[model samples]
Target: MKQKSIYLIRHGETDYNRQGIVQGSGVDSDLNAMGQAQAQAFYQAYQHIPFAKVYTSKLRRTMQSVQFFIDAGIAHESYEGLNEISWGVREGKMPNSFDNEYYRTLIENWAAGHTDYPTDQGESPEQVANRQKPVIDLILSRPDENPILVCMHGRAIRILLSWLMNEKLATMDLYEHSNLCLYKLIYSYETKEFTIEVSNDSTHLLALVMHQ
Candidate 1:
């Protein structure tokens, strides 16, 4: 059975990440200094792989994380389906008592097995999984994008992978994740199924630099 593969990376860290702010799909912040270093490390580590295509969410962070590839003349595309789950009214606020309680509650709820509970003005895990469906289908349809390089956000990527793994959405975050970490999922055309080739791997950036 022929299998299709994609190389996925969670976008590098942002200032929001460092300061504990909520930077979801609604927040279009770019990569911070640490984030840039992480991206460069990834590029240097895997520059040998000829990515068939690069796909990212419609956010600056995702795109910026892959700017090296784009500069290398690698073809790329964007899909809103890959964006992070919107954090609603908490978009720019820090996840602290001083700023907002909603963000913490949201995270706690998600981790406590309440995956479908939506943000007051944002989205739920179920909603994220639903929208990310098309992105998965599109990648499967285009095998030419084999070794498709995907750059996206944290929470949303978990939902995407959970959908691919046929796991319950409540257990989605069971898959470990980190900034600039890489994961791979392969789909077999013959069987019409998917398999995770790798998950939450960031050894390539190890000891490269320290980050918060």
Candidate 2:
């Protein structure tokens, strides 16, 4: 059976990431210096692939990360469904002692298989999955010949992949993702099944890091 392929890329580091601040969906922050370099590295690495379409989250970081691909003449589109989970009340807070305790507790719960538990003003894993699934189904329904490149946030990508694999949401906590990491996915047309061909592949970034 012929398979449809999708390349999922996590957006590069952002100013919030560098500053250890909570960004969530409250603000659309752009990429930091390291992020720009990472995006460029990704572009150079995947330039040979003939992607049929490219998708990016509405956030500035994800959009900026994929801009290189568009500049290289690749067809692309932006989707708000690809945006990160909202952190609500904690959006612009710095990771200080006051917030650190709350943040640690939230992260621990999430990592400990609590998909339904979310921060006081944040999105639950289930809620995020609910919002993202429809967008993914739309992508899946496209013609098999169309290879897609998806640029999105870390949490959203994790939720989408876990849903595709029918894995528990908590399993996402086990996977470590780096900025600008790329994952390859293959979907079986006949059986309607999907498999991950690559997860968090950053050899391209590593090589660039070494060169620097």
Candidate 3:
């Protein structure tokens, strides 16, 4: 069975993240100063991996997070499918009491198996999964890209992990994430299964941990 390693990570923090405002796929924001430092730390830790290619969402934050590798001449690709889940009307807005309650209810609904439920005019987990299917299939089919680095958004990463492991979408929240955290996975072609080597690993950020 041919196997490949996939290094998956979420983009670093943005002003929206630090300010506790929602920034979904629609809000194209860049990484902040702290976010840039976190990205540099991650690149320093994994620079020896010799990644075959770098993949990121169309969002700038994801691309900026992995800019070092891309600038090093590593092949790169971007996909809209990898973008963050759209929070619809809630995007770019700080969560007020009502927004908080709505978010709580939305998450509870998702956990209760209402996977198709979406925020007001937003995309559902099922919708996001459907969009991601083609991108994932393309990644798996590329034999030349043996070991790839992918940077995406938090909600999208959670959805992708759940889909890859064949877990219920309702359990997506079980996959925790932070800025620039990594999830290393191995995919076996013969078994057509993915084995998670690491999950939500942030050891590379030990230096930044003390300050942030």
lDDT of 2 by residue, 1-212 (tens): 67789999999988888787878777799898889999998989888888888888778898899897888788777877778888878887776797888878877887788989876777888888888887888888786536889998877888888878888887876555778999899998888888999999999899668866
Stretches of model 1 off by over 4 angstroms after superposition: 98-108, 111-114, 210-212
State the local distance difference test value for candidate 2.
0.84
Candidate 2 has what TM-score? 0.92
Best by lDDT: 3
TM-score of 3: 0.98
| Total clashing pairs for each candidate | 0, 0, 0
- TM-score order of candidates, best first? 3, 2, 1
C-alpha RMSD for every candidate? 2.1, 1.7, 0.8
The regions of model 2 sitting more than 4 angstroms off are none
In angstroms, the error of model 1 at 204 is: 1.4
Who wins the TM-score comparison? 3
Question: What is the C-alpha lDDT profile of model 1 across 71-156, one tens digit per residue?
Answer: 99999999999999987887887566744565567667887878889987889999998888888788787877767799998888
Q: Estimate each model's TM-score.
A: 0.92, 0.92, 0.98
TM-score: the better of candidates 2 and 3: 3
The models' CA-based lDDT, in order, is: 0.86, 0.84, 0.94
lDDT of 1 at 16: 90
